[model samples]
Target: MNAVSTTSAERVRADLVRARSARSARESLIKGLLFLAALLSVATTTAIVVTLLQQTISFFGEVSPLAYFAGTKWTPLLSGDQQSFGVLPLLWGTFYLTGIGLLVAVPCGLLAAIYLAEFAKPKVRKTVKPILELLAGMPTIIFGYFALTFVTPVILRDVFGIPVSEFNGLAAGLVLGLLVTPTIASVAEDAMRSVPQSLREGAYGLGAGRLQVALRVVFPAALSGIVAALILGASRAIGETVIILIAGGQSPSMSLNPTGSFQSMASFIAATARGDIPQGTLKYETIFVVGFTLFCVTLLLNAVSTRVVSRYRQVYE
Candidate 1:
């Protein structure tokens, strides 16, 4: 009996060792796959940057950097008479649309997030969350068409009596705001949800009402993530192409008014390419320069978001 028991114990120990070894091998394979995916993402970004820089350098070779930067007009193709290439107008238009988009999206999205996270019951939240997420999944072109037909004419013209143009920045910005609202709402809600339940309970224990607890405790605690969400939404608004291309006018104007017609950087690229600008010409290369600028702006926003999120990460003992 003693001998038999010893043999069974030895067999069980060997089986445990083999199971641990298999688990370690599986973990190592997962780690390798994750590392490879990260490397591929970096490679893709580097390739795109390199390609844009190469084209922009060739463009600068044809058109002097001073002419490209300081020129007031942007008439790249002028009916065999005169040509100009300035990017300031496009930059201004891009910022104008982006600013308007933020104005509309931020307030609405933040409020929605606050309501859902702090106030809503579980049943209400479950029903509403999916509906909001559905907005994010909808195609951007549908928003563009809505802006062109339903939103622009009806709201801007008949309701407000504002002189609505066919391709106005206001409509584009408003529609873009709607498109980005879901993203901000989802991120901000997640941030609010991450706040410690203990902090909220303490607030309640101190004779604080639900509103006071949410406003004074939860909102402040989640400020960093809220800011991150706003930055991310702004980045998405800035990089948008189809909505701006369809609703924003082809004319790149340096105007601050959302009511005015303008062209964003993405719209400019689409418009310039539509014309007969040769692939190797200065006009064509200018597209890359604009694209590079857009890329840098979004990259900076993402970096700021990363730092903010990292700094505010809650520590546990």
Candidate 2:
């Protein structure tokens, strides 16, 4: 009897060992696949950086960086006397558009998020949130056309009497604001929702009003995430190409007036791509330089988002 029991115990032990070994093998395989996925992303980013840098070097070889940075005009394809390579005008155009977009988006999106997070019933949020996010899925070119046809003619020119031209930054910026509203609202709503319910309850228990609790308790707790959402919205605003290209015009000029027509970095790139710029020419190289500049700006925004999130995020047990 003792010998039989011993044999059965050893068989059970061997089976358990085999099961653990199989699990170990499966885990190793999953880890390897995850590592490969990470490597693929890294490799793609490296390739983009290398390609941009190589052509940007060619651009600098043709033009002085000082002239590129300081020159106010961006007429790179004109005759000898007309040609200039000033980058600031286009950069400023982009900044102006993004600022206008934020000006419109920040208030509307935040207010919408506050309503949805702190005041809306569950059914109302469930219905409204999806509808709001649906705006994000619309084609960008369609938004461009909407800006051109509706916003320029109906809103900025007529309703507000802003004196905006047919192709102006004001139209593009306004439409871009509507386009980015979903992103800001969704992200901010999620962040506000993530605030601890206990904190909200405690505030309510202390006889705090809904507005006061929302502002004092939840808003500060989720501020890092709110800032991140705003950064992402700004990033979307800056990276927009189609709307600015179509509605904001393709003519590069330096002017701060939102009512004026101007070209963004993205619009400039698109304009050049469609024109007579020959391959490997200075004009072509300028595109890569502009692209690199846009890349740097985007990277900076992402870094700021990371810093804000890490610095102010609240810890909960």
Q: Considering every candidate listed, which one attains the maximal lDDT? A: 2
RMSD of candidate 2 to the truth, in angstroms, is 3.9
Question: Residue 197 in candidate 2 has what lDDT?
Answer: 98
How many steric overlaps are in each model, in order? 0, 0
Off by over 4 Å in 2: 1-34, 275-277
TM agreement with the true structure for every prediction: 0.85, 0.88
lDDT of 2 by residue, 45-71 (tens): 999899899999989988999999998
Candidate 1 Cα deviation (angstroms), residue 303: 1.1
What C-alpha RMSD separates each model from the true structure? Answer: 5.2, 3.9
lDDT of 1 by residue, 153-174 (tens): 9988899988978899999999
- What is the Cα-based TM-score of model 1? 0.85
Model 1 regions more than 4 Å off: 1-38, 79-81, 274-277
Worst 10 residues of 2 by lDDT: 251-260
- Score candidate 1 by lDDT: 0.87
